[model samples]
Structure formats: C-alpha cells, structure tokens
Target: MRPADLAGVDVLILDRPPGGIAAFDLLETARAGGARLLCDVSDRDHDFEARIAALGLEAARDQANALHLAAVERRAVLALADAILLADPAPDAVLRALGKPLLPVTTPADLKAVLQGGERI
Candidate 1:
C-alpha cells in the first residue's frame, strides 16, 4: 500500500523474505503514515551458514548461501521496523548492532498477543 493508504492503520506486520524488496519500502511508508511497523525475522536461522556447511551436503550449502543473502535483506527491513520478532533465539550481531526494539515471538498467537498489548505496537 502507498503511504497515503496507510493512514490510520493500527498495525502493519510483515514477514521479511516472503515480502521481499517491497516490504522495506512499505515499512517506511506505513511508519510515516502513522502506522506501527513490525517485522518478523523468522526465515533465517541463527547459525544457518555454519550449520549447513557442517552438514556436508551440496543442496544444504546452497540453501545456506540463500539464507545468508536473505539475512542481509532482513537487516534492511529491521532498520525500518518499529519492533522486531524473532523465530530464533538471540539474533546475530547485525541485529544487535542496529539495537531496535526486540520482542519475543514463538507462535502466531505470541505475536498477535504482543500487538494487542498496545504498548510498543
């Protein structure tokens, strides 16, 4: 949605990687329009690159590479995000570096509950 279209939106939550390039722009736009932006960084595992390489499988290696790239993209989304939800425990150093708000999320219900809390949004 365009920035104008986000007017009065209560919350805008997006899954990175699935939303791809457009998600980054949308997060910024929605935030500008006074909507709360939340990013779910659940696609990439914490030790994806390292663990996949240790498995010694060609296909797994490729998947690891792809996950690494996706992690890079997630960083951009995190920059625009108002709050962050993690599928993995303690995000990597990059996320720690950004230092934006971080929230725990184990399931869809967990995320929904946080959104409903009405504090961070």
Candidate 2:
C-alpha cells in the first residue's frame, strides 16, 4: 500500500515485515503521521521449514529458503519500530540491535496496558 493510505493511522502493528523498498517509505509516512510502530516479533519463532517438511511437500527446502529470506527482510521494519511485542522477556540479538523497548506480553491485560502507554509487565 502507498504511504498516503496510512493517513490518520495511530499505530501500525506488523506481524511480518513488508516486502521490498516500499516498506521504508510506508514506515516513514506512518511515523511522520504520528503513528507508533509495533513489531510483533513473537511470530518470528514459527519454524516454516519444519512445518513445510511435516506437510511432506517435495519443495519444502526451496519454500523454507524463501521464507527465511523474507524473514531476513524484516530488519527494515524492526529497525524503525517504536517498540516490540514478544512472548517472553528473552531478548535476541536482532531485537537488541534495534535498541527499542521490548514489551513481553502474555495476557490480554498486559497487551492492553502496553498499548495504553503502560510499562512492561
């Protein structure tokens, strides 16, 4: 989607990073529009390779490789995130590199608090 489409957006929660160069432009627009960017990094833990293999797909290897590449592209979005939503307090190197606040939320109340500008639980 174009940056202009993000007008009036208060927050942009990305489960996965947007593909290609447009990701940065959209993010910049959102930020400029006073929107908070929150990356839900817990989704990164899903093992696409294992899942594809379990499904017995012959092209599992190729599919897994493609998925990995897509995940790698997420760095752009992560770098611009105002905060990260994780399943646990454990911080990975990538997340730490972003230097953004990590909010480990396990319950709906915790998520609500975080979204409302509350401290990490």
Candidate 3:
C-alpha cells in the first residue's frame, strides 16, 4: 500500500525503506492520519563500523552504505515515533543523547514484557 494508505494504521512494520524509497520520504504521509510506528532499526552506525572492521571494509562496503542511510533515517523516525524496535544497545545511548521519546522494542521478550506491563505501544 502507498504511504498515504497507512494513515491511522495500527502499525507500520518497516524493515528497510521500501524498494527505491527512503525512510524520511514516507514520514509525513505515512503518519498523516496518526499511525503508530513500529520501525525496525536492525543496525546503527557503530554497529556497521564494527561489522566492517570485523569483515574488512571492502567486504562490508555495501553494509557501510546501508548503515549511513539507516543512521539518517532511523534517527528521524525515532524522533517522530511512539516506539522503536532495534537490535543494538548502542542505539539506546544514541536515543538518550538525542532525548528522543520512544519505547525500545528489541526482542520478543521485550515486547512481551511491555504487554505484560500494560504499556501498550
């Protein structure tokens, strides 16, 4: 569905910006009707750097590019989101430092804990 169609949606599970799309591009339209963002931030800049170092820069070149884009997009999404789903603890620090308001939904256990705690997000 188009971003506009997602307005007022209960959840928008974005894995990596849609084909040929950037996360920032859909922000305004996607949230226009007030939808909760379940953004997936699988990696951060630091994590990418670590991957590159481990596998060698040349081997991880593609990941570097993806990370650069993710850093820009994820930060923007987090700023406007009701909650965030990520895999890295480093992102916690990034979020805290930016003072962005978002609930971190990392693993299934974490999501379960949130539901159990009555923190619907």
Candidate 4:
C-alpha cells in the first residue's frame, strides 16, 4: 500500500505493532492504507502528539474526552473508512468489541492481509 491512497479516508487505524515501529512508520502505513491514524495515548496529555511531530505526520486534532471516546471515535472513523487497523494493544476488549474492521496489531502480515480486502481477512 502507498500513502497516496489515504486521501479522503474516513476511518483511522490506531496501529500498535507488537514490537513498535517508529512513529513515522505508523503514520506512513496508516496513510498508505487509506486511513488516518487514530493515535491512542496512554501517557500524559497529548504525548502522542510529540511522537506524531517526531514522525512528521500531519493530521487534524482528535483529542478524545476519555479512553472510551477514543475507542468510539476510532471505531467511528474505521466504520466509515475504506479500512481500519488496530494498533492499540491495551483495552483489547474495547478494540475487539467495537467490531469495526480490525486487524491485530501484532504483525505486519496480519495488517497486509486485512487491507488486501475490506472483508474476509
């Protein structure tokens, strides 16, 4: 996949690789898959933003009120997206329960398989 395909994508993938890649890798892959990155932060306010900056990813602000809001918004974005990839490992229950086009964040192969087709992955 290529980042150019991300244009007009509504769904955002909060990709959390099993062994995390650099922030830029996440940004590039998500954009390539035709989705935005719904970064899930477990740290102090907007620390994830620093990572985004480090990676040089430009995106609109989507600060969630709470973790649940983050999850819901992520799901909402995915539901509307051509694709959505799960990157956040915590709250596996939330991510898995939402059921809005998901791929395990554990491996690149899983993500590639899922993105190959919107369904049946």
After superposition on all CA atoms, what RMSD does each candidate show versus the true structure? 3.7, 3.8, 4.2, 11.5
Count the clashes in each prediction. 0, 0, 0, 6
For model 3, how does the per-residue alpha-carbon lDDT over 2-103 read when each residue is reduced to its tens digit? 566665665565664332244555665666766555656565442344546776767778567876555565566666665566566456466566554345
For residues 9-64, what per-residue lDDT tens digits would candidate 4 score against the true structure?
A: 65454533212234345455666755544433232222333334444433423332
Query: What's the lDDT for all of these models?
Result: 0.68, 0.75, 0.58, 0.43
TM-score leader: 2
Q: Estimate each model's TM-score.
A: 0.64, 0.72, 0.56, 0.32
Candidate 1: tens digits of C-alpha lDDT, residues 1-121: 6656677887887765333667656666777778777777765443446546665687775677676666566566677777788777677666677777777798778877888884464
Best lDDT goes to which candidate? Answer: 2
Better by lDDT, candidate 2 or 1: 2
Ranking of predictions according to TM-score: 2, 1, 3, 4
Better of 2 and 3 by TM-score: 2
Where does model 2 exceed 4 Å of error? 45-68
Mark the regions of model 4 whose C-alpha exceeds 4 Å error after superposition: 1-75, 82-84, 87-91, 118-121
- TM-score of candidate 4 against the unseen true structure: 0.32
